[model samples]
Target chain A: MDSSASPLSHPFDNAIRLTGSNGHYQGQTTAPYANMVGPFGGVLAGVMLKAVLQHPQCQGEPVALTVNFLAPVADGDFTVDAKAVRTNRSTQHWYVELSQQGQVALTATAVFATRRETWSAPQTPYPGAPRSESVPAMPKVPGLPGFFANYDLRLVRGGIAPMPQAEARLPHCSDTLLWARDNPPRPLDFPALAALSDIFFPRLFVRRQGPALIGTVSMNIIFHADANTLARQGEQYLLGEARAHRFYNGYFDQSAELWSSDGELLVTTNQVVYYKE
Target chain B: MDSSASPLSHPFDNAIRLTGSNGHYQGQTTAPYANMVGPFGGVLAGVMLKAVLQHPQCQGEPVALTVNFLAPVADGDFTVDAKAVRTNRSTQHWYVELSQQGQVALTATAVFATRRETWSAPQTPYPGAPRSESVPAMPKVPGLPGFFANYDLRLVRGGIAPMPQAEARLPHCSDTLLWARDNPPRPLDFPALAALSDIFFPRLFVRRQGPALIGTVSMNIIFHADANTLARQGEQYLLGEARAHRFYNGYFDQSAELWSSDGELLVTTNQVVYYKE
Candidate 1:
């Protein structure tokens, strides 16, 4: 597939497609990205960000985004209102919302800023893993959610598959390392990265070695890469490392970092999820 | 030193006090919590949370808060408008803003939830450190910002004090571990925890062994404790571990975890800060 093909040709582009102007946009949930209960949170996040990015007055690239999932988004037409709440000389702040039938389903706040050269270093060491080419992609399992097929995931460790019964008695570790990219090979962009930030399965599944009813209450992503860096990572697999810090009182928090194939840290994301026992 | 003293007597309470009803509030910046050029970001964060906490419609304890610092808050009276955007059976979402002179200075989104008993565990190991009683509190230094005096901080390791010149050639590490609590022994609460989450100095100062022009652009905190747990904590110190993950271009990110004296995880926070060379 040619990278320069029309945006409608890519499933991701079509899923996040928004139309309207001056902060109001109309979008629809696509079946290709549906989750167990609603659309994938990452796609919803991408839709919210797309509303901002498509706005006429938006400045710079996205540096941070906080999305709060308020209610289950029913499949169909939805609207987004992305407002640039404040625009500073260096950074801009945005308030965005996704709604259906005049009811809010999600609310988000984002920070966008232009970058300049400064003292740069990575304090968090990269979790070294085998090259993407060396690892086989996760096989497409039947009966999985439709969204699973949209990503080419190469699990390196701590996958969601259940451990042996003997090993289940041992301490559980909800950590996962994988190399992932959009299927059909779309170039990397801010929206694509936003969606990829949420590609990991819920930590509960990995810890318990099984699935449960879970929903993310709130998710935050801080982008460490600028437009130039993201463009440099076009169509490349991103190494993702994720783990849970604490799962207490019906909630667990997932912290993950995404890096380019060349070991450049691109983004760090965290989300709090609620689960039923 | 009395935890039950009138709220007006405690500087932290006074710093975050809001006067108003419904979703609107009026607050002032107290001198005790002043930062280099304005109020400390933590106190501003507390003020934002307090607005929602004081609202009559608030349903439950805060689970997550994301504060975006758009402009420098001036030292004066400010108004906060907190709206409960959505309220589900288990969670309530809030959109809050702090404004001065009719201009938005800070905006935040928060999630509050009534948690129930469920399967719970901690995946992230606690970083062991010396007991709070063993380490002397950080002494009050002249010329430091007034907010520094509000927290009794005992440094354990990775202190901000510069390394010896002979050791300066070694690789820089910006990690900090400290025991912290409100000075004068205020009891633990959501507002106090929010303030402590921003207590660490910027990573640039720790890495370069000197101060620079820095400002936090956005901060997110996910609370892992319930109201009962916080009440049990009383005035005990919280062990805080903070470090920078990636410092690139003109921004850097800080990730920190706060734990109770009993080794229970309490809160995890992340923020992206802007720095000028």
Candidate 2:
């Protein structure tokens, strides 16, 4: 939609870029795109994936991705090393690690596949939710994750109060349904969608009135749509829904889905998080 | 329980063993354990993980594992190379691969964590299906994957007829609820649970009368039980439930859960399968 803005110059592109040689890459964390600790996990996830996508041996579109956060990433320069572990005629597997000062902070794996047309049936029914245009966007506030400002997020249900008002009333449930689209609208693509996958607020905040320290320890996403399907929905809002199934042993499991407005399931993502009081 | 049978001598233990130095190991496929095209995926998955668990630097218990089947394995010896991608105070990440004739066949990554006691809750309701003891064990027959004999499996619903009687009557839905336990009554551990996670018949077979060629392209599993919890159910049957949410474009995704009879959720696994006519 914004032909004058080259994809190469997009903030997402700049933030996830790598520059180095001999199987290593160097990147710098960007501000205004920063989460509470570092760059948004989704963007960091994109960076890890970008390392592979930009690799000489990379092949096929990403169909699955798993990222494990070993520690908090410090804001500043970091390095990523991606290697293709196995490659078949139609599929490939990769391992990626992001590190700072010779210490590994994040580790990830991705699977790419060349898909062919076949019989399709989606059993998960789309939610009976309202349209994006009918809801007001979540207002940006100080002391919140800066990355929130980069997207137009409209909550349809189960939203937490602002940080300043968080103590007033806590949500009764962790389920959340919302409409989200990147600000300055960019075409829907793998990296953008990957970043969007982690954009939901931690389920802990949604369930409890009080705030707690929380971080995603491991996340896995399965992609169901092809590039053409994603590109066709350029600049349009996608429906997102997330809920936690279990909370245990200082960790919990959350499952979320991203779907096109018309009801095409794009991705299903799950994560395990660590929370501390 | 068979006290005279040591776990090291179990068929499952023998099937997942590897011999080698450093991070590289070698293994061979066993007869009566073969799938339609190669060794059963569950066995291969266990073998890959075995390489890591057996590694000298391996630490902690498995918290998450993701295996990508890049290619089909020939029924013979294969090599596996595993590396500790990163290690932290409480967690370790590993990358593993299975190869034959010097080419990559399958690749996987695992995250091991030292879990601590904390608040726990499982929201998924335990199934209302009948107890496993009341159901009949699936009979072993010719033409099915020989690996089915490795475990004692009893189906409660949405089960396909045996190959000989497959044409007699097919299940109407793509859902399966079964009870499964190691034939030799081995103590359940990470590797054993990993293998059991994939013991279900393909959802496609349950929905369609005839079988089509299919293979798991990728799988991700999250472990919710600890060693104490797993061992407490020693050699007991686990309630296994599986269903597919969508099938499209040569690929479909199936989600399965293994729960202890005492109502503890042990693992939640998901995979994308490629099918062809």
Which candidate gets the maximum TM-score versus the true structure? 1
- In model 2, which runs have C-alpha deviations exceeding 4 angstroms? A1-8, A20-24, A141-143, A162-173, B1-8, B162-173
DockQ of candidate 2 (2 decimals) = 0.53
* Tens digit per residue, CA lDDT, model 1, B161-185: 5321213233688888889999889
**Local lDDT at A237 for model 1:** 97
Per-residue lDDT of model 2, residues A5-124, tens digit only: 345576777777788864589888887578888778888888888888888888888888998888888878898999887777888888888999998888888888888887677756
Model 1 error, position A163 (Å):
9.7
Give the Å error, residue B275, model 1: 0.2
Q: Give candidate 1 regions above 4 Å deviation.
A: A1-8, A162-170, B1-8, B162-170
Candidate 2 per-residue lDDT, tens place, B102-173, comes to 888887888887877765666567786677788777777656777888889877776676532233333355
